[model samples]
Target: MVEAARALFVREGYHATTLTAVADRAEVGHRTVYVRFGTKAALLRHVVDVAVAGDTAERAVAERDWYRAALTGRTLADRIEALAEGTAGLMERAADLFEVVLQAQATEPELAEAFQAGRADTRGLLRRFVESARTDGLLAETTDPAWQEETVALAGQAETYLLLRRTTGWAPEQYGAWLRRTLTHVLAAPLR
Candidate 1:
């Protein structure tokens, strides 16, 4: 049902997608969708969550290998590179659906809340990375950890990836490399 809804939402969009259509696509009863998801907004939220997490409900973003590499990297540059690669993969998979959700936010209160919640979650993850960098003495003495965290969070956003990939025709690899280099320059301490 989630797969069905995701495909429909991507092809037909949020406003045009109906519960009956989702049921038909999934080959399930209408009542099954209603009973499982309760509402279209709830179903959309599930779709977004699954997409952002790369189609797995079992593991979280932090548990992913790429994210783990970022957290466990030997230096801030390595960490930023790993983070950029991971974020590029995520944006490639979820950018379209995220745009759909963003568009629906004005009309759907639940989706609006979900969008904000997702941003907060991203911020929290960046904060953890910033704290780790500070602990490892990878940050410059003059660097403001809070400001760096916010900058990383904003730089890692899906919209930036979408813009570069979609509007500028950059491949995912190119985008990832650029992101890694840009973030390293922006967030890393000066080399001795």
Candidate 2:
């Protein structure tokens, strides 16, 4: 049933996905879906959670490892490749559910809370990573607000990859490579 709802939610945004459609997709009765999930919003949230499937936390760890490597003067290319690989894997797994989650946040306040909570957790984890890097003298100082913004903006690269996937149907590795190249360019230290 969760898979069915996830499919419908991805095919047609959260506002349009209905219990009846999910029921049809799942080959179950509408009453059964409602009994199992309670509400459309609840069902959608469950589907999103299933789609996320613990990847967010794993991705956070990957990001920390990549950034820590960068601090050691490792080539930005290598770090970007690592970051892109981790992001691409997670994005591919959660793309459909992520679409539904975005739609749900746009349309439902209750579901938005869950989405916001996830966002906050990611930001908090990033904050910890940056703090550690600062203490290790990898970053000049953590006082700058832009340090936090940069961490959050990494999602922009993932969003761009999603757009390219929809338009060009590129393989995951191809997209990851492109993201790595772009990130390397953007993240390289300023010249003296």
- Candidate 2 lDDT tens digits, 1-192: 977887788888888889999999999998999899889989977776655554324344324554455334344355455556665665676776766676667668888898777666645544544444445544433345464446434543435556787899876677767766654444444322
- In model 2, the clashing pairs are none
- Model 1 pairs in collision: none
Q: What lDDT, from 0 to 1, does candidate 1 have?
A: 0.82
Q: How many steric overlaps are in each model, in order?
A: 0, 0
TM-score of every candidate relative to the true structure: 0.89, 0.64
lDDT of 1 by residue, 16-135 (tens): 999999999999999999999999999998888788888765888888888888888998888887888888888777887888888899999999998888878887887787777778
Candidate 1 C-alpha error for residue 25, in Å: 1.1
Find the 10 residues in a row with the least total lDDT in model 2.
54-63
- Model 2 deviation from the true structure expressed as Cα RMSD, one decimal place: 5.0
The per-residue C-alpha lDDT of model 2 at residue 122 equals 49
Q: Name the regions of candidate 1 deviating beyond 4 angstroms.
A: 189-192
Per-candidate RMSD, Å? 2.3, 5.0
